[model samples]
Target: MTALHPPGARERHALVVRGGWDGHQPVETTDAFIPFLEDHGFDVRVEESTAVYADERVMGGIDLIVQVNTMSTIEDEEFAGLQRAVLNGTGMGGWHGGIADSYRNNADYLHMIGGQFAHHASKPPEERTGGQSDNYIPYTVHITELGTTHPITAGVDDFELVTEQYWVLSDEYNDVLATTTQEARPFDAWNRPVTAPAIWIRQWGKGRIFVSAPGHRLEVVQNPSVRTIIERGLLWAAR
Candidate 1:
């Protein structure tokens, strides 16, 4: 086993806790950004359990937390400790369910993060020349006028992507950077279009919070625009 922080000249400390439902490819998804973080001067510590959040000694020293776990349970102590760390200026960031959909029963976690994954908009199966995938829909993300000036989305153009269109339950507190629209489908009765945040930032006391609704799939996370947004978000969120 490796110590949380190995002896070296590492400037920043990042703890990546990845575990939970594998449908999201937690390990593989987190792997995509590990190299990028390391190359950018962070000593990354990867763990497969949420217990790391309970270690106050370790949590206190961490400069950032990159979680990839989805729909997992976290104890109160663990959640509290994690919250304290972020409140004290340790940055927290993640994508998809890792941060948004995680700990569905924990309201503190949700409030701190400023949003929760409500559901993915359902799309009717498409009739194509070949075949179609279930629950996956194609949509375009529009960078908000505000996003054009935010460091995380600056210079990044609106782009089209094929994945789950996450309809997040967000609040006014979030500094929304980007958004996507969900058009009404035959099966659903909303009868109108709804727009949701695709990327956002929040503040927890002295800490910085960043969340991107991409990363449902490795391919989505690998998209040039998506990846760039995530990379910049991480850097911006780090303490």
Candidate 2:
């Protein structure tokens, strides 16, 4: 529980925009960290729509934006304001589909975030339980050499999770911190194994962007390793 802002530091504001497909449990997931942000000295504000992204006066004062909306549409004006805020140095961060799989039609959003959720490798048909759990595969999240030294991932050891393993489409602009490799099993289509970034950060103008692909639910968000990385990432990304 290290304080992000020391005593005497100016008060900072954090905006949490949450909603969209409920399957991702966006509300619950973001709720898990609001207290953390408050404890760290942020004046936390919660919004249920992406409309707030369009409020320039509000966006301008924000120190950080934690978006938890999944598979939702954003108005062009809203998207523009968000882009402007980040470009001017307001940090942004989120986990799982809340950030990665959001605004599917917005290429600019994808380019800004530096990654998109391509797919979630599923279990074989016989093993499927006929629900979202079908993609709950046990896998390891390997900390890269760079992750070991980055503030967001420093000292966090490689860990395992039984959850949706995201196949992310990302570019070199991302400073990858952690990765997960999808094995080429007999049932899978790809012949060779594919590795996707499980966690990463990017510099967008003066703002910093942090993303973690492992938080598919509240339980996953509460994982010690996952929780720690996200907390540190939030502070590290803040303006």
Candidate 3:
């Protein structure tokens, strides 16, 4: 991994807030990258709750925020502090349900992130075995023309994955980097094929935000291309 800041530059601070659903393996997944952050010259601080977001002292000095809480609720004051921090130039980044599927009831949070996880289409009943694997389908992440030049995705090619292909709800404000298509098979209800953003970046106020829809687990996060994008994204999003 390359160091982000030049020698002699002020040290950067990174706050990793991870908790909520364990199915996504928040702790393990976030742990996989903490060293990378530290290696890139960040002073890393780890927190297990969103409560830290409400602390102005902590949020005020944070250069980046890596959130991994999924399907969890956020307090009004906590979210307000997070909003203020990001708007004031603290960057944020995360993957899969950690960021996109978090705070399901907070529309403003979704607005700031620029996307939400709608659903992951599952296999037909006849083909299904049991559990979450029913939703795991092989799909290709296609890099866009713009992605060919974007700092986070340049040089990365389309790649295939046999995992949960996320069907996301996103806005035009996002700078889409890569996408995955959910096919309309005979067993599926959707009429036409839909392509959702697989990876993207957004600028909210003075802060930069990066999100990748592919990291459903540690193994997925460790995938070569996915890992490369995320590593680059973390640095790119930092203030």
Candidate 4:
């Protein structure tokens, strides 16, 4: 008979957590990923405090962070710890406008990710951010050839989805994975040739980043294609 080795003492991960915006169900969204990491050899510890940004003690010893909160302020020390954690090889990943559009009051975080949520261009000049838009708009995402050759998306092909077609003002540093274009509707103007990045990956110091623009609802989080992208992204980002 062959003997199996027991798990090691060092097989653990540190997670710094904080987020709000009930629209995204920040708590559930963050928790959804815990099982996946734990199953993949990571001992996950979650800081459930929404004030994790102020708790100096909670920052060190964590291996990665999954942020799901939207629209909050962050202090310098908290930002520093996260910065150090990633620079030391920890990984970070998040989706939708939550993580990417988080901390409306902090400029540093926006600079770290390389973009901010500009005005949602999904609407017309009348209400701008307030009007209702259609769902199941039926969008097609084009997978960049470079993305198909990359680890997180390698072997993945073009797929279609029904969700918010996020039109983002992107940072130049990101390695874009997929993009979708929209035709101008009477309610909005997509007449230009600009493409919206559906998924992207980036780096911050030694840390890694994966961002997805499609998780506008719980159903999207459960979609097979979205799940595949997220699972692969988490592993690829983790050290």
Candidate 1 TM-score versus the reference: 0.92
Encode model 4's per-residue lDDT on 165-204: one tens digit a residue. Answer: 7677787798999877767766655455567678888898
lDDT of 1 by residue, 19-118 (tens): 8888788899899998888877788999999898899999999998999899999999999899999999999999998889999888889999988888
Off by over 4 Å in 1: 1-10, 125-132
Model 2: CA > 4 A from native? 1-4
Report per-prediction Cα RMSD to one decimal: 4.1, 1.4, 1.4, 4.1
In model 4, which residue pairs have backbone atoms overlapping below 3 Å? 14-62, 14-63, 19-69
Candidates, ranked, TM-score: 2, 3, 1, 4
Worst 10 residues of 2 by lDDT: 1-10
Better model by TM-score: candidate 1 vs candidate 3: 3
Deviation of model 3 at 95, angstroms? 0.2
Which ten contiguous residues of candidate 3 have the minimum total lDDT? 1-10
Error of 2 at 159 (Å): 0.4
Model 2 Cα lDDT, one tens digit per residue, 1-239: 66766888888999999998898898899999998998889999999999999999999999999998899999999999999999999999999999999999899999999999998999997999889999999999999999999989999999999999999999998999999999999988899999999999999988999999999999999999999999999989989
**What's each prediction's TM-score?**
0.92, 0.97, 0.97, 0.84
